[model samples]
Target: MNETLAHEDLPDGLGLRLKVDVTRPLTDLTAAVNALCDQVAERRATTVVVLELAATPVDFREWPGDVGIQAVNRWERAIRRLEKQAAVTVAVARGTCGGPALDLLLAADFRIGAPGLQLILPVNDGHFWPGMTLYRLVQHLGVARARRIVLWGADLTLDKAAELGLVDQVSEDLEEALHTAAVLTGRISDRETAVRRQLLLEAVSSEYEDALGVHLAACDRELRRLRRTRDASPQNLVGQAAS
Candidate 1:
């Protein structure tokens, strides 16, 4: 299994289209992650469309010595960076998504799964691999369902995943999903989007009082920008002339 990652600009500069083939070893996956990070850091796209292809299962146990652990760490960091840095990240799951592929889906802002798509966890010797993937599942699905997935070895079907908020959309057509993602990313500045995403991420761990100041600041910034736009409009100019 040779995992690969590539990206190209969407038509009319709408965003970037990223294709990820997950059937590869950790070394290749790490390289792919690095490439993705560089692409996002360039800030050439406002939204990222992640096409997750079928993934070949990865066994962490097979990674020899410290090399395996280091690769895993780097891979996780790269995925986190993509989620935080990209203005809007949307993932489309086709066929089976497991291991590293599932990790990327969990990090995405929006997830769309194709019909018959299955989400799998890594199991070795009849036991689930205890890793950060567990944290992701728990964060998205809460404890009970995450437990079912991690401990009971349950696979998430497309409909069930959508019902549980794991997948935002279930579409048979990949193009439709991409269109939906592009539409959803419309009319927002990348910087503002990043701020809003940060707020949401922090809200999960912070109390209302702790988050109030940041939220208020964001509101102030938005209001000022709106006022500036209103003042610059043709309608405002006409009203001033009449006065």
Candidate 2:
């Protein structure tokens, strides 16, 4: 079951590699989601790359009874948890990415795609699956573009995805995308990254006055740390000794 999702520790524990096969069965996908949740819970200063393999669009209607429905719900929850918990989550799309793959991509903080990347959404019996994925698309791409993709059943090319801000980078080279992700991950400490992420999330629903306190608290922490560092510097120590 773990084989369905391979986990690799990046050099120097900078992040993790989560290779997922979206074509796998619901049970396998569930296992993969569980594994990802475990990794996120660690709250390390690590970047997570969700590398997707080839997969056809999944149709939830085809799943057997309530079990399939439950799996879909659980999978979505897992992605949401990852989005909120991981210090930095990046999704890399190569080849076809649809259904579960797209869901994971939307949940990531950043996305990188290959030149041949194609994003698809599954339509069940002529009706699109109305899910949280639609809300995510709207948030990232706005209502007009989200409608075009969700209602019109339009496929997204890598270039268009980047143009719409859905993807941060578009490259034919997989290694280039990975390098970019790693660099982005190293730009901040784990604690600061998490705090900033929370600030952004709160800003979406919080007024300026309401958000000021939290921001100021974060500022105070930064200021105090800086002061401490200055006090402990060699120059400060030497001055104190001379005095």
Candidate 3:
């Protein structure tokens, strides 16, 4: 999978650029995802990013449920790790984002879709697909909305996606949107961003009081780190010091 596609470091601070032919077979989807995760870790990129609908669906004559489950598990683990480690994960989308693609897109902190982008949640194909998508949606956007999308298997346009909070914004040009994301990514402090992300997840999963405690502790740690950085800027190694 790594050898099949070329990855370019965008000169304009675009992080990593992945080019996937959406019309091709995705038998290597799992491997591609793993490679991307490795890249994210190696680069220490504040925003581990992706441009969506890069690969086309692989049409298997007979679906292998076991392989599908394994792919789902690997994807879920990778997404959780990347989301936690990266300061501001971003997804720039064009065309249709569905199935495993949608899974990856939803994992991003900010999703910017193009004018013709479409979001498809297809869990009702009269077959057993993993329930993680529904769970994540429920966790992000409440149960009712999750049910509406999962149980009914609704497909949404870019406008509806923005309205439903699925995508952050829809841009006429994808490159412009990516450039905008690059600027936004540059402005955020990694430690504070990571802490807020964790706190937000905790607030979603835990009680309010517990969430408050975690947030306050995160704030304290951030403040102390800032003070240390201010006091000792010239002493630390390059790219190893506090951001």
Candidate 4:
């Protein structure tokens, strides 16, 4: 909420990485979701949108039970958008994560956890909330593994989450970890990044037989792209002259 400390809507340069500081919503993020969309829609400049989660899982039990179904649906859609956003979405969790925080983290392309980080099931009156996060947990860990966390409310320590590949990196120094993440991703353009993400998602969700066609199409496109590059290269021109 500190405007002075937060980066502006857009990144200043190619070297800068923008962190999308999550506002711990009391009921929903419907109002702020547009900001998330805008961050990803930036076509001119490559950006890395980092969502920081520290005061998360702040007693979801205390949340009012009056959230409407429509609001929840909108929230779910927004989270999906975040997952497929062009900007490389990064989640940095410190302390406990559950509810919306957990949802965002799971949707991120990269996840980093600071020391003392933990994950908890978002339960309401003894049952887990049937949000996109639940579906994502199943997608990430599969049915057998997510069952324990959802049905039994099992909490995961940072080390356990990292072992499961839920948390990509664990660091005592979060800033350095963030910088490392930026380097690792190499900030591809937004549309291309989203296309790649969609391909990966389909690889997981699609049936084995159905996956082949999709992969073949991608392969064809890649081949064409490579051919274009090769034909335009200086070596190819020299070889053509020699021939």
Candidate 5:
């Protein structure tokens, strides 16, 4: 995974650029994802992962469920870490998405879907493949809210995805949507983006009383950081003695 990424560099400040094509083997896709995480951490910037899903059924080189559990676990963990990394993650979904594709989209900080985007969790042997994708759906839209999607699997049209808040933007011009997402990512500290993302993820299940202390601590940390920034300013430190 440490090998140099074959995609675009950090020249324009949009961190690593990577592609997720389900037609490829799971190993290849997972390796690419892990590499993206590493590069984003090093650059401390935003990353946009473009998902390439076939509009029709894919004859997967390697079925996601056919892979060993360890591999699946590793990929899922990478996505989880990616979600909490200091770098912002933006996902672009163009066609129908499901399985690993849907998992990646859910993990992203910002998701952009094409106007005709549809989401599904592929069924194998008459049962929906049980993966962390289901867990993520539950996390995003609690168990009750995600009943149909979890119980069996439901196709989510672009409009439905937007209504469910799964996608941040839908556009005919995916490139422009990505540009808009990149601009939005710049409005916040890369580190703070991860912090706030973690807070939001936890906010879903955490009770107010239990979450209060954690929220207060985050506020205090921010205040302390602000003070440190102020004290380190050139104007404020002009007369300070070298210690």
Candidate 6:
């Protein structure tokens, strides 16, 4: 049976939590990822939380056959599925992070890192390993910067990563960051938020003219609703105040 450490090790109130300690055996890592993905899919949680590299980095070379491939596939599928559902994922990082840690970060919508956070893009003896990491890096950073990171295996400090827009924030405190994220997401209605998110996604690969009409109509609808709600306020109080 696959055993997971108790959740008490991390801070509380995360909808669904996934913690990966690379110091654990490869078997345990794969089990944790699979279990986490299943829980996320089942709950359809609005947020997916990750605690990354809390221990020594596990050497991918030590993983047995099929474990590495399955682990990567599980994470890839979970991230894409969650993205389509208007769910946001956050990666909280500390210490030396590369390989699978970097890959998971790319899969997240937001990344929070500590002072020592360093990013290592995948490369084997000067040859870049072309995988989902490369694909996502290119999508976010464009071809030139992506190539530089991958080919040369550049290490990015937390401040440097923030400058490059790789991470949302770099702070010593993880609890505060989590609370901020919760507050930001809590104010918005889920359905409306999902609609807006889908529209933005469509706009990315869509032509301006084609998206303009739909975008305008959605905005106008919301505006009209707000105006009506505002105007429908009680007039008796206003008149009493005037008298």
Find the 10 residues in a row with the least total lDDT in model 5: 1-10
Candidate 1 lowest-lDDT run of ten: 58-67
Give a tens-digit lDDT track for model 6, residues 1-243. Answer: 234422222234445556666555445554565555565555543544454555355543322224467665765665455455444566788876666667667766678888888776665545566667777777778788877876766778888888888888888887688667654653452445656766855754679999999889889988997888776667855765778
TM-score of each: 0.85, 0.82, 0.80, 0.85, 0.84, 0.69
Task: Compose the digit string of candidate 4's lDDT tens values, residues 1-243.
Answer: 444224444233433333433343533354455555764575456677777776533575422245777777777777887777677877888887776677778998899998788887677776677777778888788888888777877888998899888999989998778777765564564566787788877776799889888778777877998999999899999999999
Instruction: Using lDDT as the measure, name the better of candidate 1 and candidate 3.
Output: 1
Instruction: Give the winner by TM-score: 3 or 5.
Output: 5
Which portions of model 2 miss their true places by more than 4 Å? 43-50, 53-68, 240-242
Residue range 1-243, candidate 1, lDDT tens digits: 232466677766766666676655667766776676676677754655454554355443322223467777887787777767646777888777777777778888888888888877765556676667787788777788888777778878888889889899888787877776777674453777888988977776789999999999999999999999999999999999999
Backbone clash pairs for candidate 1 read none
Expressed as tens digits, the lDDT of each residue in 1-243 for candidate 2 is 757576777665667777887667766776776686687567555555444544455443332223467877877777777766646777788877776777888877778888878777655556677767787887776778888888778778878888888888877787767776777665653666668887876676689999999999999999998999999999999999999
Q: Give the distance in Å from residue 186's predicted Cα in candidate 4 to where it truly belongs.
A: 2.7
Using TM-score as the yardstick, the better of models 5 and 6 is 5
For each of the candidates, the C-alpha root-mean-square deviation to the true structure, in angstroms, is 3.2, 3.2, 5.4, 3.1, 3.7, 5.1
lDDT of 5 by residue, 24-54 (tens): 6667777877776766667644444443333
Please identify model 6 stretches exceeding 4 Å from their true place: 5-14, 23-34, 41-55, 60-75, 124-126, 188-206, 209-243
Q: What local distance difference test score does each model get? A: 0.72, 0.72, 0.65, 0.71, 0.72, 0.63
Candidate 4 Cα lDDT to native? 0.71
Give a tens-digit lDDT track for model 3, residues 1-243.
545444556656557665644333345655565566677667654544554555344432122234555655675675677667554667777777766567667777888888778876634345424456666788788877877776666678888889989899788887778777767775672657877877776676798886777878887897998998876677564445646
* Each model's backbone clash number: 0, 0, 3, 0, 0, 0
Q: Supply the global lDDT for candidate 3.
A: 0.65
| Colliding pairs, model 6 | none
